[model samples]
Target: MIHAGVYYTPGSLKARFCLAGNQATKTFCDQNNICYDTCGKMLVATSELEMTRMRALWERTAANGLEREWLSAAELREREPNIIGLGGIFVPSSGIVRYRDIATAMANRFQAKGGEIIYHADVSALTEHAAGVIIRTSRGQEIETATLIGCAGLMADRLVKMLGVDPGFIICPFRGEYFRLAPEHNRIVNHLIYPIPDPAMPFLGVHLTRMIDGSVTVGPNAVLALKREGYRKRDISFADTLEILRSPGIRRVLQNHLLSGLNEMKNSLCKSGYLRRVQKYCPSLTANDLQPWPAGVRAQAVSPDGKLIDDFLFVATPRSIHTCNAPSPAATSAIPIGAHIVSKVQALRESQINPGRTLRAARSVDVLHAAFTR
Candidate 1:
């Protein structure tokens, strides 16, 4: 199954840690000959509340055998001359990778193993039986196989619904707009400069990131997206918009985050408002330094009761598994996650084992096969 990399990965959904995530990505890159940078990452804190949270993060990571440092305001200024904040948690190993390059390598490896890949194959239907599963694609193709799995990214929730499982969540698209710092302003930040995120919210807030090419990027304020595949602010699909509007659960969430939603929309529309978000930590940026970059859509899983699904959630059947909620850190933890899923499939094949019992007891994973299949 193809995994959705970084962007689809959520905001502290799986873990409120970046070092572990980055380290995991770095490890994958090293083992696969994928090129990546180790520019490190910094999460700056301004208020006493942020400072206290930073300290807690430092201690928690340290206890987990992770390397982290608590830096002073002056120290932060020395390393990042433009950074303005009280202090921050510095994770030296946190860096960025060329996502495309990593994805290409993985695809090549998959094909090299004699695995057939059908690009642009839109799965339209699924039928499961005691013998096997039949998958129908929009391109007028069909395949029968012993087992089936789905990793349809933004369309995962819909695809899972076709398989007869509710999965207890819906995919709500969130648009995150970004800006590349002008060439001259690239030196303004030495590492990834992130403002401490609100513990109550999933978003990490706006921060400056140094891509693998050494260019600084800022502002990825999250806003509701009208289309799942929409890449531009104006791009919209009437069907997608209608589907989202009809969901009462989604409406409840919008009401819950009313002010926050409006603020994000403001930042998305106003360049200065977006810049001010990053300016909280990086004071050197001017509106002129904001260069245009393509925006990304996040497939955020929202529960039926108006809560964000904040972990790796997988719903399964006798012969198939569907990823319901897998946000950030997924790219970094791909290898381990794949291994974990493989174990679940293996557990199901035991003749004497109760499939439901096997799935539930399989490493604490949330298996919905028994709930749905029964």
Candidate 2:
């Protein structure tokens, strides 16, 4: 999904990158002959409180320089007959595409440019020195490089710790479970429908999304996962569980969000309860309309003091840089994010060449292409 820089703090990495990425991604798709849909999206408000929040969000998005249209109840109903709301906001620049396809295209392009990708090699350890970083795989293979950029999503903290850096945070896995609407109801809504989200929470409330293939998906209630990669309710990892239980940060998070977390769990276990959330705006949906769909795990970084890192976070050392936290819209903002990382790497290389003097010959530096597993 392409985000229009809404719902993020102004001047934050997320807002800046998302705004740039919205255009960059579409341009890339155009150049590569990839298919996408700028079908637009709507944030619907079901109650008076939500209406007030929606107005505030409209102002925020405007501050971010996004084009939007405020919709009254009549206008919303005219656009989506099946959706009921007190009011809504229409963002024309928001869109959707298959990110898997984009990733594959990028990998193909990288390989064509002499980049190598190694699979199934899990990195076991990392050692940083004045020269560079030494990466050791589980299979006992060692790779030496002049620079290392760790984009490890779920294992970001562990990778930092392997480099002997104090991460000051832990990754807490939250499973977002989705349900695909039955095919018969595919055209129920003309645009992506969302709810006015709680400002205090990181997770967006349950909403309906129209996929590139024309199917609508409902859900994604955020619930704590027992395993980092857990996709099913039955999947559990004792090691992951033990670590979560021992973390003071995780304990604080649980304490602060106890009620909401319990409600999410209850909905996850009870199909009827889950249906009620979407029913608030899209009442035409029933329990039977929800079909089983694949789930996704989010790697959320929580500070030692229990605050969720709501913006993009990066930590750098002399020889290495780590993307510590990249929350929602990361996929949409990938292009700009990559460009930002590359710029940082170039700056690091220049700094190493001359401590006090700026190096103008950036193109002369040879960036080594190395792969580390996991």
Candidate 3:
């Protein structure tokens, strides 16, 4: 819920989960009449060589079961007349939604089915024993679960450490700042428009996105977050800053990607630089056009060796299952992810108990019911 889109690699846990999430999102929206749009996406090629790169991306998308069509510059112009590009690859399936609403809907369905979700009850500690895992919160409240599945978002790394498992990585927060286009420019785009991403970096570059609510937003420039939940430029936490700076893994990672890191820092500091990124697709914009919105922090996992964890990392032992990293597109894939987790947990439970008639009868909704209360 807290992490963003970097915890994935092609054909990785993140990729697989995201693929499942994509389909699951469409289905959930259809079933619940939620406002969702697969308004499609386009990766604009700004140059001839970039056109080839877009082709390669098309191939990757096909492998991932994403249907896409190559669009010539003229065709791209037809779709987004306000935008200009050398050429582009049109992915008709990629779309956007209000994640906040989607989350509320999911929580509602989960609880209506007898599932209990205690929001704001953040778990601070977990102790494993012969019978189950004892979870303790900051308020000293405790709950015993036959198993503990940690999806502790921004604090995932810290939670993993609390469980005494060192994945040898630290969570480095990258804040993505966004700008909503002025109402007059809402007609600028009909689909999600993205710049061809730099393969060397995790970010896919700035683009134009049309939310389900009938507004267009631009930006989401990557910047190093001074605080984990820091949404504003002025927001900073001394303790968090100290923690990141003191982290050897973070230092090494930054050192390794010094150029890209420096560029990102520059963009964050220079409004012109950030505007230039958004202007690639929307040329009509000027400095005054950029408007601030709540920024989302990407809880990027970095290793001591300076490598970012580019795949969905699931660390499972006989005792517990920890979702080390689940970021964006995660909201889109929450249902399938939840179902997959439920299946694995059931399999583990079945290994311990006999497959009896009543247990078999309850198989459909029983474990899912247990998860609600736990």
- RMSD of candidates 1 onward, in order: 5.3, 5.1, 5.8
TM-scores of the candidates are 0.88, 0.94, 0.88
lDDT per residue (tens digit) for residues 1-374 in model 1: 01112222223324422323455566667888877767777779988999987876676556544567788999888887888889977776666778888778778888999978898988889997755579999999999987676666799888877867666778999988989989988678778777877766768788787776768788678899999888789989999999999987788889988889999998888898998887777776789989999888888888889888777777777667666666666666555556555655665555225534433211125322232110
| Candidate 3 error regions (>4 Å) | 1-10, 350-374
Clash pairs detected, candidate 1: 9-327, 9-328, 10-327, 10-328
**What lDDT score goes with residue 44 in model 2?**
98
Over 173-259, each residue of candidate 2 has an lDDT whose tens digit, in order, gives 999999999999999999889999988777998989999999999979999999988889998999999999999999899999999
Q: In order, how many clashes per candidate?
A: 4, 0, 4
* Candidate 3 colliding pairs: 8-310, 14-312, 21-333, 116-372
Number of the top candidate by lDDT? 2
Clashes of 2: 0
Q: Which candidate, 1 or 2, has the higher TM-score?
A: 2
- Model 3 lDDT tens row, 1-374: 11122224556555666666676677777777877777777778887777777777877777676667888889989988888898887777677777777778878987999989876777888887656788888777899988677777778778767767675677888898888877777777887888988777777777787876677777777788888887788889999999999988888877777888788789888889889877776688887877776778888878777677765555554446666666566675576567657766666576547435111101111122233211
Cα lDDT over the full model 3: 0.71
Each model's lDDT comes to 0.72, 0.87, 0.71
Question: lDDT (0-100) at residue 70 of candidate 1?
Answer: 81
